[model samples]
Target: MNKLSSAIWFRQEQDTLILEIHVQPRASRNQIVGVENDRLKLRITDAPVQGKGNEGIIRFLAKEFRVPKSYLTILAGARSRNKRIAVRSPRVYPDWMTGSIQRALFKIS
Candidate 1:
């Protein structure tokens, strides 16, 4: 486990959870890899162009977190692989993610 695994990567923004993410585009498949330097590492199937990777990230996260895509917002790093995304009005969060809004994604589903 890296540093972020011990702590959640999310920052509360009103009713949203802002997650710091580091993406690896054009990977073999799209999936949550692990934590690296406090950022959630994700492998993106889409190439980093025309926001395709960004879109993939949002869609994957929405499905993973069991939330609507509209509720997930890219707060920063839209054009870069490293990004900060926000999940709004979440109805469910994995038990492992109790305190850490950010690091939880790495350990759990």
Candidate 2:
């Protein structure tokens, strides 16, 4: 594991990257707000009702990572503000995930 892979919020298992995230629903826009309490904080526009928030999260992440929605999976916390997501074979890494994280991902790919 590299530096980012050892962090509380991120990890890598073979071709998949796993993220521990904290979500804020019903925000003005969807955005990644950095890390808070060892989790990746995200502001989502959709309300957390009947999985809309979860769907929004998947959409946002898929766009960020340059992957299809089918390549991402909500591994846990589907009904809560905190979630564990798996991104399989991401084609791009968002700007926020810079430095060692990017280096590590590149090495793996």
Candidate 3:
């Protein structure tokens, strides 16, 4: 089986860490919900309209990862619920992401 529901891969062209997200638009809250059966499920605050949910993902992720919103960019899937977010962190490495995801999941109420 594939390891990831949405692939989080490195894009050499963009020089950033890319994440393919399975967005739950119009969710009750904004959070990096968890990795459920391998899929990364995100609960977003904004409803799925006019790119609000997509933007919410960026903002939520940026805050969760302790990075500036400017470090995140939606690389694709603007209209679709599934999205690709590029996280730019020069001082961090791939291993850091695992901890970030874990912490986000644990912190959720």
Q: How far is candidate 1 from the true structure (C-alpha RMSD, Å)?
A: 5.0
Winner by TM-score:
2
What lDDT would each prediction earn against the true structure? 0.78, 0.86, 0.65
User: How many steric overlaps are in each model, in order?
Assistant: 5, 0, 0
Model 1, runs deviating above 4 Å: 1-4, 94-109
lDDT of 1 by residue, 1-94 (tens): 4533545456666878778889999999988766777787889899888888888998888877789899999988888878988899776764
lDDT of 2 by residue, 1-109 (tens): 1323324688879999999999999999999777777788899999999999999999999999999999999999999999999999989877778664865557779
RMSD of 3: 7.7
Candidate 2 Cα outliers beyond 4 Å, as residue runs? 1-6, 100-109
lDDT per residue as tens, model 3, 1-109: 2333223332334556666567888877776665444446677879988777877888887776668889988878888866677888734443425665454446564
Q: How close to the true structure is residue 71 of candidate 1, measured as C-alpha lDDT? A: 94
Candidate 3 whole-model C-alpha lDDT, 0 to 1: 0.65
